[model samples]
Target: MISHFVNRKRELERLEREWKNVPSFVVVYGRRRIGKTRLLVEFSKNKNTFFHTFFEGTKESHIKALRKELAEFFSDEIFLSLNDYYTIFRYLADKIDAKTLIVLDEFTYALKGDKELASKLQRAWDHHLSKKPVMLVVSGSLIGMMRDEVLSYSSPLYGRRTAGFMLRPLGLFDSLELFENFEYGIRTYMLLGGIPSYLIVASKYRSIKELLKWEFLTPEGFFYDEPYILLSQELRELKLYFSILSAIAVGKTRISEIGNHIGVEARKLYPYLENLIRLGFVKREVPVIGKKNKGVYKLNDPMLLTWFSMIYPHKTEIETGVIDIENLRDELKKVMALRFEEVAKEFLVEINKRERLPFKFERIGRWWRKGEEIDLIALNEKERKALFVEVKWKDLNEREAKRILRDLELKAELVGLNGWEKFYGLVAKKVDDKKELSEEGFSVWDLADFKRFISLRGEV
Candidate 1:
């Protein structure tokens, strides 16, 4: 199995810092399969830890399971018979004289099993666990439940946490560690979007085509029904949400477009779209230099994007055992091309971090008005400077590269940044004579630069 623990140094360091501060209540939450439990397990190494995972069962069952685990850890027969949360916390507060880590993974499961679990934990922490030199870490996979029951201001545990953060999926640079070939790594990233568990499974396959056939195209495949399962876990009105996602995945970006496609009124989609945005499944974007109210929605999760684009459209044939790889090739390429723009943006962000860009951009995003659009625009508003770029998923010779750059400049002029220091650039899969283009004062980059950057960072 691929190591899912490769790129969590920063998260580990944060946990270490929290460990140094006793009586810490740390809340770590994210979507399912984003590796919250793995991160906590890594942090618990060599420490005095009592780790227990809660399940979807009765409150008494949850208490009994935790008590059993604690009974073994503390070697105290009394804990085995303990029937309540308060007494457990009271016992820990009294027994844990030294620094200790107490991790409650999937705490939301227990919370759902008992509606008053959060309030009960709040009472336990306030009356018993607060004075102890313990770091109590609780993590959950259900984003909406976690926020409502633990992190929201209306929650009983509000203002009680010492630290909290949503664990995000791995970025491009860190995700490259999973594959030997840079090109394949990019493709896998486009398909899976850096979720560690998914990347681990993807890494085991020889090629994307093979991986898709066995893991995605077949009904018995691991990912064939993944999106359905994921949606069912955290959402009600499954059909509407599925239709909304399907619409966005197929390029119905505007609220009007999505609503029309899904056969709902535009205004009614706001709540559903907001929920998806909050759950990290969909994202809304406005032009970097345009009216804020003019926003468009897109599928934020790469897996869902791939599923809706490639699998959902061909679901009938696949379910009937007709797996046509060749027929799906063009669709996959289209998805890759769309995702390559995002990859290009990520590359520029990394470069900006190292101060390698012409000037440090305060914001970066796609820019458009009317029909003319730029693939990316990096702006340093304080300095009144903008960098406009056109991204392509093709191998471009010098002439083609210059033509793109020229078109980019023309588009930049239409953006109405007349007084701003405007610079033009091009990014592509491959660009011949990149050095010559760079010498001509264009910010040029290709796959070679990406490879070099990964190698230099020692991530390969």
Candidate 2:
């Protein structure tokens, strides 16, 4: 079942209203399955429009397709004989005395053979359609191309666009619409992320585990090549990127450690890491509360992380139908547990960006020194203060959490906050509700408090 389109009304309204303004060209782009088409469809449902998706076709082939669309809308004799897109756009600009919405999906593909296509469109807009009553949307999936060709500083359309949209995957709240329960579903979402196309194939009818199996195990399943499809466009060294991403997914966060596992020099990995960061799939961050140079990196796309950690290593098992679900369960569950706390951090940080925090920190990250290690550090960069947070998904028991906290505090003391402020913090699967926090003199942010922090602060 499709979850109700619960958010992004503002984005929708902005696109809907674009026709009222001059220079109404919008560039909407994102990674595959991120609902770019859906958002447009949602807007298109309320308008009169020309919508065309460009893919896997030669320029002549695309022109022919455009001709067919024009022929059907106007007539073969009137419009099909036209060869140039500029002329067609020029002519159509006059057809509508009122608002018209034109969606050119996968616009990069349309411009692939003709690097001058953006320039051509600009000429058409300036010479003819500039005075027309229309809103034009150019959408694409290749982020590098979209940014360089359409949105780049040197491109002809650089300053011509009235609005820009890079649609993102659905969030934690959106997942609630997809699942009946919170706990089990969060884990599933941690595996698949918020890609709409994946959600289309994920079992809305079955248990979460069953859906995951269908997504990853069954040879003919829709998402069998989903991760590969998404990664191929953005990364050239698939194996190395896979190894590094898998290592991170399975729970190593440090650069040196990830390099060690991937058998690459840390210096060699920088370009790949930077590309992933730009693609919005991975992140490099320093402690929100600690030293600026001491930083860690993690996979930002939950599905990619989950795919590399669990799916890639288990591909052979799925191929032979020899996969033991129970055996797979034990191994994947272990990986999941290791990665779960990191997911908790993302869930926390995503929420915390929305508002003022009790800690009032400027940054949040994992921290390590030549000797000491800490799970999380949130620094109030302005105040020069820091909060040390340790997450426990394994030992929710009070004594176990307390032991972790004690070690975390010791670790924090070893690495002085570079003459900044001081605060010790602990986070867990379930903070010991019975443990009197103010009495203990240690500030504790339990799961509820962490979730509250996110809810109150997460602006985007």
Candidate 2: lDDT of 315? 89
| Backbone clash total, candidate 2 | 14
Best prediction by TM-score: 1
Q: Candidate 1: deviation at residue 198, Å?
A: 0.7
lDDT of each: 0.90, 0.73
Estimate the TM-score for candidate 1: 0.97
The digit string of per-residue lDDT tens for model 1 on 1-460 reads 4674778888898999999988899999999999999999999999999999998889889998998888899889888877878778788678888889999999999888888878888988988788888899999998999999999999999999999999999999899888877787888998889899998888888789988999999998889999988888899999999999999988899999998998999999999999999999999999998899888898899999999999998999998987677889888988888898999999999989888889999999998889988999999999999999999999999999999898888888888987999888888999999889989999999988998998667533
RMSD to truth, every model: 1.5, 3.7
Error of 2 at 80 (Å): 1.8
TM-score of 2: 0.85
The CA lDDT at 186 in model 2 is 60
**Model 1, runs deviating above 4 Å:** 458-460
Candidate 2 lDDT, 375-432, residue by residue in tens = 7777776787777777666536667666777887778887666687677666655666
Q: List candidate 2 segments past 4 Å from native.
A: 13-17, 73-77, 203-208, 235-240, 243-269, 289-297, 329-331, 346-357, 383-385, 418-424, 432-435, 438-460
Query: Candidate 1: lDDT over CA atoms?
Result: 0.90
